[model samples]
Target: MSGEEYRIGLIHATMNSVQPILDAFQVHAPQVTLVNFMDESLIYELNETGIVTRNMARRLLNLVEKAVMGGVEGVLLTCSSFTPVVAEISHLFEIPVLSADLSMLEKAIDMGNRIGVIATVEAAGPTTKTLLETISSNKQKDVIIQTVIIPKAFHALQNGNRSKHDELIHQKVQELNRDCDVILFAQFSMVRALETLDFTTVPILTSPEISVKSIIAEITKRRIVI
Candidate 1:
């Protein structure tokens, strides 16, 4: 077990999430091997319907199962919109299963009671807010959560205008910064906007780095040598 290179599965709903997690692994857990399972249709269908359908959940389950079959030691779901789906299926596997946003949110709750959630899509906002609320309740800490949804920026990025996407998100982050004690980017892809921001008084948390750290912590907690 000492020399083993653990393989972790990254399940994604969009290509936007892929690079952020890869970057995180490079910075934090370079020893582990990453396997990505992507289904762009999942995000497209969710946006079209403005809901997570039963079929989407099934597809996510299939992806997770496929990753397990492929010999992954852990599973990380990179889309914040599907975090709740991870909850339902994680118990089915013996390996560590995680939602990318969970560790970030937990850290956000610990950092401040006034948490601002920023998302580039309508689907991610409510899900992130819900997760923050749950974490706050379980911790018995009251929190005020505000969510800003910027779907136009998502469209801009989709159309290959990265500058426009970063501008829109940076502007909203500035506005949120004025009031929030801590801000959390609700999606892994949204973390890119931080590159454009010059400075902020409040702390901003992103999922990928925090998620990778949590994955390593989980592996250690289970006493797995890697």
Candidate 2:
């Protein structure tokens, strides 16, 4: 099937992550139709609870189910903190289901032994760390992972201070570059910070582009027609 025949569903936990993913899709797969489902309250609730509860998982499942019922050819969850939940319900859906960070994590694991994750969201750091550990164990690869979270940057973005957010993340990236073999931006929302800085040394990875490509590849591989 071609890009024009696919309708991709995106579930966003926060509004900040949506634009970057949309921009990537436009450049990489413009013909595909985008179906966005956003619930900004999910971020607030996750921050309040400090973890993804059972009810939170069910809410994510409902969003994916709605996208499936709406005739979407694939569903992608744009929240790093909710990746495990997406994995849990992926078997229930006939269409392709993806977590925004899955492809990025795979790439990071393959790139080097020491991986650094820079994240704006508090919950994302631990979730990504857990994922990296699991993937490394399964692949029988000895990998070292380090995660740094800048809550201030996230709050700055939430308050509409894009420059401040970028500045904070850029500083963290520079610090991490010294020790890590590769750096991965843990949240889809954090990808915007890359525009402000030029880091030519360590390879910096982000979720949106990789996730977009992965979804497109899955659509083609399965020969799913929408």
C-alpha lDDT of all candidate models, in order: 0.89, 0.89
Q: What is the lDDT for 81 in model 2?
A: 91
Q: Write the per-residue lDDT of candidate 2 for residues 166-212, one digit (tens) a residue.
A: 99999988888999999998988887889778766599999888899
What tens digits encode model 1's per-residue C-alpha lDDT throughout 50-109? 778899999999999999999988899999999999889999999899998898888899
Model 1, C-alpha of 18: deviation from truth (Å): 0.5
Question: Where is model 2 poorest over a 10-residue stretch in terms of lDDT?
Answer: 1-10
Candidate achieving the largest lDDT: 2
Q: What TM-score does candidate 1 get on C-alpha atoms? A: 0.95
Model 2 CA lDDT for position 186: 92
